[model samples]
Target: MTVKRHDGRKADEIRPMTAKVGVVPNADGSAMFSFGKTVAIAAVYGPRHLHPQFMQNPSTGILRVNYDLLSFSVAERKKPGPSRRSKEISKVTEWALAPAVNLEEFPNTVVDVEIYILQADASTRVAGINAAAMALAHAGIPMKTLVSAVAAGKLDKELIVDVDKEEEDFREGEGATDFPAAKLSGRDEFSLLQLDGKIQPELVPKALEMISSACEKVYEVQKKALKDFIENPEGGNGK
Candidate 1:
């Protein structure tokens, strides 16, 4: 196992995290979350009636997520607006938070979540998920529990809690395995799991254990941000 990370974090340690709510006053609800240098902002609009009458769900309200990585967010700037990658991640994010939300009470309606990466080092999608989860709650959506997420995997021969850009680019030893996962904070339930690299089957359990633990820490931060916003809606930017 590698003894030290390039940024000096222990294998199981995460970079400092920052979370806040009410970042966008115009939106019904909004939040921002960052993992070290990677930052994401999310805004929630609606519970409004579904348009296009044919598409409305009588059984429950539907969630529509639009995720985007700003053109200047990375060194290799992407084209502006939604791309295939953003669309796919948006769908995965919807699936991640859907289970925690109780939408039956608002059938035939829609909840739109807009997420943008203001800056990205690595783990942008997971950061977007974290921000979006808080925005949903701030919008007054009833939820069973908050959802938290992280990208945890193997960095060479070592296990890591949260993968950063340097670790993501590692091309030595066993290489890197980027596994982004999400879970409901108050329960032992996984909401999403996507692996971008290979790993031995025997190591799966250990990786999952690490991911679960990291998410709890993320959840604590998310929970605190929400409570802080409730107590003092005018302010809540924290680390």
Candidate 2:
């Protein structure tokens, strides 16, 4: 099986990433991210009130994430209903972002992180995760670790990084399962893991390795955005 490559990039190459903070005024803080053809936005709201019954811990603040895909993000228009996929993503997002926030200070309040995918090519979840981290940091949310996500897939027996939609289809086929592939499967190492096709256990480690490298690159972008936000309270461009 022959695999197509993007711009001759290496198997672990991440797309050009950019993060911008304070894009939304309504929210306490916000960030936008561009990962190749993928686009994601994240907004943070409140250490505000939470229903008494829903409170998980009165000693710490709550972390919640809401994820949504725009109707026009893909070829098909998505319905305006909650999807299990989004729920799963939200859960992982909350986990990945939780570590960064010092929830103990807020007690009964809750912080909400909202993620919207405007465009998706591949690695939308990872992009969304990264965006959420940036938004929280922009909001001055105290966190321990800066989390990020990315994916690796096998195409025609070749393990490639940042698999786009076309490559994803090829990787999902019956024969694709036999090839080596990897994914981010931990909240500590990665924010989320979702796989539609098959992957060998050995490949899982490789995927984590690639994801670690990618996350560092993304973290740099996040730091830059947060730094700019602080330096130029007016605008990143200093307008």
Candidate 3:
């Protein structure tokens, strides 16, 4: 039998999400976001001096974002050292957030964004991106647009959005033949593919459609949260 999500959410439904800004006292700006069971915290530091001097771009400030996955958050015990997975995630987070930030305004300076995964149900990368974006805004960093991220996957022969661990397991077996197992294979369509299974090339359009819609819904939550923080700066609690 196929495992269903708790809310009976459709395949395209993104988990309920909330964003709060300025959660840290020491960082210049910070934000925390919860998407279903996955939680991520991001802190923005910088425009600070660079080391060795040579690393500085000279024309524009650098945007550095660190993403850490806490061992306690996941079910399995994780090794302390950084993983190739984390490195890949860090690169993607930086790319997704850099375009939104106006680095040119602070030439020779650097803005560092840190993302910590407090909980990992699923979709941690998307959560990290959301948290980082909120933290940057709370820090008063100028941005062109708010970046959004989400994952789409195939399950039980159907394409789904925001697949949790339970749903994922349903499709992982030799008996799992009926589902859309081969609808889309390569993940080139998505900015980041978190799914372990494959789908066919023809189904790429459908997957993009699902992911985009989910992102817009999430984007609203982020905008509202940042707006609330702006109206009540003290409420932000970011030092």
Candidate 4:
């Protein structure tokens, strides 16, 4: 059976996307990223000194992340403060991005990444991580490579890449799976792997391959966005 996405995207196609850097003038580095209806803005601040209490290692810089969903971002207004879900996402985002950064470059300082979701359809975490990675590059933080992410899911017995909100809802039903993964660009190492639903063991390999290909595409966009920003600091559309 052929499954048609509501947005008209093919099973293997990602949503229409765009990424822009230097969106927040006050931040050391900032980026606005969008994937279809989901939009995430990220700001990076500091390679500055971390307070003694927050400093965990004396020889390496700390990578701190705060992921927030604005109250008006969803269909129903969300609460103002950080929820348990947001906190967990923040921690995972930090961990996912740390592997791509050279934390030792800043010694005892901290690089803080803050992501705000202005809108959401699905795959908000992936979008947020992408924005954060770009923001880090925009801020001139030393990094091994940009980190890119994508979510692949099983819907109607067919595997799909970059699932939107409607497909995500479908995955919540029986026998469906929503797998979100992230990896550093040009490397086989995975930085994040999360499975939201059950999947046949045999399907894992196929799903990983699908998401990895999607992440590579996203990485290309991220690189272009950062390059445009660097070349045209005054104004660049990030085409």
The most accurate candidate by lDDT is 1
- All models: lDDT? 0.90, 0.72, 0.74, 0.88
Candidate 4, after superposition: displacement of residue 50 in Å? 1.0
- Report residue 174 deviation for candidate 2 (angstroms): 6.4
Clashing pairs in 1: none
Per-prediction TM-score: 0.96, 0.86, 0.86, 0.94
Better of 2 and 3 by lDDT: 3
Clashes of 3: 9
RMSD of every prediction: 2.0, 3.7, 5.1, 2.2
The residue-by-residue lDDT of candidate 2 on 1-239, one tens digit each, is 44556456677677788889888877887888887898999999977787665675779989889988988898889886669988877887777667557989888888889999999886787788878887887777777766666666666556666666666666334434211111222333444555656667777677667666666677778788888888887885331
The digit string of per-residue lDDT tens for model 1 on 3-33 reads: 5888888878989999999898888889999
**TM-score ranking from best to worst?**
1, 4, 2, 3
Candidate with best TM-score: 1
> Residue by residue across 81-153, what tens digits does model 3's lDDT show?
6799888788877877776778887888889889999989877887888888888887888876777777666
Model 4 steric clash pairs = none
Error of 3 at 43 (Å): 0.2
lDDT (C-alpha) at residue 140 in model 4 = 89
Given candidate 2, what's the lDDT at residue 36? 87
Q: In model 1, which runs have C-alpha deviations exceeding 4 angstroms?
A: 236-239
Clashing pairs in 2: 100-143, 100-144
